[model samples]
Target: MKKVRGIYIKNSAEIALMREANRIVSVVLDALGEAVAPGVPTMRFEEIAQDMCRQFGVQPAFQGYGGFPYALCCSVNEEVVHGFPSRERILREGDVVSFDMGVVYERFYGDSARTFAVGTVSDAARDLLDATRESLHRGIAQAQPGNNLYDVSRAVQEFVEARGYSVVRRFVGHGIGRKLHEKPEVPNFVPSGMAGPVLKPGMVLAIEPMVCAGTCEVEILEDKWTAVTKDRKLSAHFEHTVAVTHEGPVVLSVS
Candidate 1:
């Protein structure tokens, strides 16, 4: 590994290990997504995540991290992120849920998120999910060598706003590998007057775009971990672990 401007550039071997780590994340997310249904408790997803981690011989990265109690951040409806899973919080028809998951494999970390609709959702909710997912891909496309980090930020911001959604600013993405969060924070929106670091080969970034149908403003729930849209409107989130390579951006978290 090499550190340039405080950002760690992963070597070929490191990237390979990260690939396996992220692959596990993808598989787990697939299972979680498939399990979404009405009348199911959110805590069931956490149980599924733990079971999958064990079967894959990996460890749940979020469990106990920063005193977090659950393996999955199961944000429902207006909840933006860091949502706590509970048996009482059962899924209802037409609710949108976002599951942010992470895992540790051989000391490397993988992080990803996806929003799913429970049963049949409204047209507005469906649009939010589609736009959030596309925004993540747009940002990933900009993760190329010699490009400015803000380029990725700009892509996500513009694509999301153009679709009539607001990007959450309070919780941004970040570098991942060896640690859950690393140097050079990856914001969905570009900050004024900050160019950020130039993209380079071996740089791995967790590009997550959190979007809201209402205001971008966020409010923390009484639990202090769950983030909700201040206006109580719908929100969506999507993420992937991407690596900047000579050929272009490579998504490491795909199955």
Candidate 2:
């Protein structure tokens, strides 16, 4: 593991607490996946997740973080991520919903996201979800200690691009813990000649892959929060808060 300044590396004890926080997120996500179906309003997701967080004695991490109004980002179809949840925004058959949420437990943060199929989705939609989730795993595999930061970026970019899909360049995964956004940002596409910091044993990151079925280009909607695709094609996102260890990369946000 690299000894780097300015980055917080959790010790085994602190990692245990982080795992507790991540477990809460994991269970909450599972419940959300089951509730994700046709005819369910997007705001319902925010309600359920918030209730679950309270039951677990945790706080919604995104509720007021940067003034985000809801407990979750309930983006649908062409919406890549950070879509505002609304009761008017209802889900229907063949629609794919991306549920992104996080929790604050004992002052530690846990984050994770997943895309779900509401009903019988098209072949193209299925492929997008499959590729995006797979890219997340591919990116996580590179989160091992001693690996450079961009290794995870290359893994995601190559996997998605090779499938003829585009990786959203505007948004990348990030380091998460104690505070929501941490230092040493993790990008999905690592540009030429830019190698990021080395992965250390105590380093914990929220590795996510924001993928698009069309161009990787994206635009911020007038809402000033929602991020959507420029080409208006479907997009999918998957994320996990992972930690680096001497043994390997350990996913913190999984129950």
Candidate 3:
């Protein structure tokens, strides 16, 4: 039976498969975490992700999807999500880069991202990363059955703003399953008078928090995919695929 909610709800069996898919994500992230540092080209990380996907027996969900050429979306410093990877974009000491990716295992998809420090970053950058990462956890904690969808959003905004950061409103967390992106349009901030739909068990959501150190305003680059802070200040992003349950929310992606 279909629920009134506009997103697909996974069953226990499907959730297990999704967990497996996200497990590959976790392993790849753990492997790549050690490789993030000064002098490494952004394209090199993309190569690492592609090889890992092949080794793990899964296909990359982003490569060739909507013309995205690489397995990983590498955004450095001021760039937010969907930054194109390139050999020219070399990491420097004190730079932070956000790597985003998705994988398909047994016909199910899992998507996640993390912002990593290149080497020795400034306190401002470190604090931005901390706040963005924590905002993701705060949002995921609200992904419980019977809670309104934007309850998760509200938590993200409150936690981020309280930490003196701004949450990105254009891009948001989303539902992921058979396809990379599913329905219900999970926003990271609670809009005015919006209660949103109620969460239920078996729902899988990719709760990502994109936080900016300055104004929340963002502008797309001429490339049309890279989103950067309009003020050119620092930004950070973190994400996880979570499954809502009677007990609470189960984070499918972990490292």
Query: Which candidate comes out best when scored by TM-score?
Result: 1
- The predicted structure with the larger TM-score, 1 or 3, is 1
Q: Which pairs clash in model 3?
A: none
- TM-scores of the candidates are 0.99, 0.97, 0.97
Q: What is each predicted model's overall lDDT from 0 to 1?
A: 0.95, 0.90, 0.90
lDDT of 1 by residue, 97-120 (tens): 999999999999999999999999
- Candidate 2: tens digits of C-alpha lDDT, residues 54-146: 899999999988889888998999999999889999999999999898989888899999999999999999999999999999999999899
Q: Provide the lDDT at 52 for model 2.
A: 96
**Candidate whose lDDT is highest:** 1
- The TM-score measured for candidate 3 stands at 0.97
Question: Candidate 1 regions off by >4 Å?
Answer: none
